[model samples]
Target: MKTQKLTLTVVMVAILVVMAYIPAIPLGPVPLTIQNIGVMLAGAILGWRNGLLAIIIWLLMAALGLPVLTGGSGGIAPFFGATAGYIWAYPVAALFIGLSLQALTRFNRVNFVTILLTIIVFGVILIDLSGAVGLHITTNMPLPKALIFQLTFIPGDIVKSIVATILTLTLRQRFTALSHA
Candidate 1:
């Protein structure tokens, strides 16, 4: 179990790293990337503890100057920049998704639609809130304006949540180990 967990954690970190290399669509100071999809998958598939660990590992690497963030950007500087909120929120979002799924599973209510909605809600609430807060603080923009600015990310985030849900459910069906306890 330990070995499997370690391997899975490494795989999740790799997924984040790979996703980071994908070109981002820049909109103002924030850029949209598919890295969140990897974060969602880590949580939904690996559960909270392991998923959080994977994200932490990836973040640490990025902080060490590895190109493990969107558009191949990394370093601790990004963590203190406008997009810092989104980066900081990754683990929290993953943990929320994992915990929610685990609870749902306990009651045998883990349906595709349910998981999809849960991911969307959690992603929007957690990631957006954190990202907006970070933007507002770093740029000294008003909170409302920062939130409005985040609206541009909604469509992409929704699509990523949907994809993450489908992929997670499909993978869960094939891998019993993915089912959270």
Candidate 2:
């Protein structure tokens, strides 16, 4: 069981790396990257703890100067940038998302609505909030302006949440590791 969990975590990390390699649409401070889907799926499919570990591993790699984050940009520099909050929030979002998924699974209520809501709140909304905070701090932007700017993140996040929900539903059925959660 431990081996399976570790293997799944590694696989999820690899998936995240692949997602990051996909070109990102650079829009203002935060670029639009499909990598958020990987973060959401990490928690939704791997369970909370394992998902968090995988995210941390990915972050550590990026911090070590590996081009693992979106846009092939990596280093400790991004951590102090306006997008840092969003980056930092990935593991946190994954933790909560995984927890929500686990609860739903335990109650046999892991449907589209439940999973979508989980991803929307924990994955999308949470990251939005964190990104806004990062903008506020790094750029000294007003909170209201920061929030307004963060509105740009919504459409993509919604799409990512939907994709995550569909992927979670399918993976939970076919993957025993996810099914247990």
Residue-pair clashes per prediction, in order, are 0, 0
Alpha-carbon lDDT of model 2: 0.91
**lDDT (10s digit) by residue, model 1, range 1-181:** 5888889889999999999888998898888889988988988888989988999899999999999899888899999999899999988988988899999999999989988987887766789989999999998989999999989999999889889999988888877755554
Model 2 backbone overlap count? 0
Q: Write the per-residue lDDT of candidate 2 for residues 1-181, one digit (tens) a residue.
A: 5887899999999999888889998888778889989999999989999999999999999999998988787999989897888998999999999999888888998899999999999999899999999999998989899999888879988988998889888877777665576
RMSD of 2: 2.2
**Highest lDDT, which number?**
2
Specify the poorest-scoring 10-residue window by lDDT in model 2: 172-181
List residue ranges in candidate 2 displaced over 4 A.
176-181
